[model samples]
Target: MPQSSPRLIGVGGGKGGVGKSIVALTIARVLSDRGDEVVLADLDLGAANLHTYLGIHGRVPTLSDFIAGGMADLSPLLVDTPMPRVHLIAGGVGSLKTANPTFQSKMKLLRHISRLSADWVVLDLGAGVHYNTLDFFNAAHYRVVVTQPEAGAVLNAYGFIKSALLRRISRVFSKDKNLTKALEERVSTTRSRGLLTFCLTDRLSMSPILRGLMMNTGRD
Candidate 1:
């Protein structure tokens, strides 16, 4: 069997109105300008406005169609932009029926995305640390979180990163009760639970389970 080529990307940030979408679209344009076949998926779920930046101004059929038992594959829903090597899985419509699919569903979408025949898949996500946005950002091999030098932007970016890392840690410690307690204590910043100490220490007494997770989550 032939090995499939890898094609995935993510551009996101914790700061609102920071022009991350514009950057993503412009990068897609450059990639398309170089004859790269690119598919931009607005993975922001609830607030997907990437199409507007690309000058697409009509009703867009989205993954909501397929997820809600629409008989068509995602292709018919690929919104065309003026860029030659670019196509889009627009996010302009939704159904209340199958609302807020699980994180597993998001992963399923990502798995299916890996099978698509494209040179690049650029994804633009919304601002925040919501599970959906974080999952989408972490799913790609190349993930970039845009941020300004402002304090609010930096703090929110820290919050977003903390949430993502803790979520992964929770997953690894999901089965170990004692480890979970230790995690809470370690992640906490109170006098009883010194997260600051952990941060300013040479080593944390994390369980093997948590150590493995920390390694995988880049917390080490």
Candidate 2:
């Protein structure tokens, strides 16, 4: 899972009307102007409007439509933007099935993403910490989390990071033989010490995570 492909950039702001998409579009334009082949992907599969700045209109082919058992091809859907070297992949408004695709569909989409030939793939995520946004953000190589100067925005941003970290850790450690066995054995048991400390010194003792690794395990 060591990434060795085109760099992927994702932009996500905590609250609505925080200029997240505007910043993404601007950055895409600047990079495109510099002759970088950038494909701005609208990961916001709910309400997407990045194409407006480029003078695109009407219903477009999108990720949702692809996930909803429809056909999609890069040549047919890579809409030309006003900026040179910059293309667009629009997202569809969500419904029941199109909003939350099945696991198989996600895997299929990811597999197809690797086939895209571009220097940069920029993902514009929707506001808030919904699963749709965070999952897409996690898929990117580098994440740009934006937040306003407000308590609520800060909390939401933190929550997004925490959720992403938790999911990543779960995926990484889920298949480890010792760690998985130990966690499953002790997940519901009262160990020698507190559950938190048990987690530190026993289940994932070798984990380099700042939380479990740095906690004082001497009490156990």
Candidate 3:
């Protein structure tokens, strides 16, 4: 039997200079060392620099080509890295426009990503809570938030987690207007920084539907 889809691991944070790319690269290296084939994708969009960290220079086919309609499949863009068993899908030095791809384009890219022939895929996401960033982060089987040991970094990381969780909730309950509204109100009124944990484990657990959704989200 053939191998199933690769497990995607997304590394992201709200603030820049938090070493998200380094963390992502490290994860790929560790996994590859364990005898697993890993693909390190530079999903940082316009500000992609994962290639530099790997000492890869010169022009190369990147995710930009696929997003720009120049390529059909993400597999074709895979480039060998210095690390054994680790491949790379560069972010490309594209214009700012490429950073904000159309919804259709984003979906297509993600679909192609799921089909990549690797045991693991490590995504280095850009800073901020852009819809594309959040969606990509949420798409991953494992999500990691990188941050420095500073007040600002911790605050931004918290904000990113909040945004990603809210986006997930919105997607899960898109059809239920009442529940969505109630959740939104609950989130807005809760001033505590631990609001997400509280909602997931406390009050929201009172609803069977929400409990089920949370369980499904975890499995996804």
Judged by lDDT, which candidate is best? Answer: 3
Total backbone clashes of candidate 2, pairs 3 or more residues apart or in separate chains: 0
Instruction: Sort by lDDT, best first.
Output: 3, 1, 2
Q: Summarize candidate 3's per-residue lDDT along 80-100 as a digit string, tens digits.
A: 999999999999675766788
lDDT of each: 0.66, 0.66, 0.81
lDDT for model 1 comes to 0.66
Q: For residues 22-88, what per-residue lDDT tens digits would candidate 1 score against the true structure? A: 7678767767776778889877775677777778886777777756554334567677888897888
TM-score-based ranking = 3, 1, 2
Q: Encode model 2's per-residue lDDT on 112-172: one tens digit a residue.
A: 6656777777888888767667767777766666666678876665556555554554556
lDDT of 2 at 15: 77
Q: Which stretches of candidate 2 lie over 4 Å from their true place?
A: 1-5, 70-73, 176-220
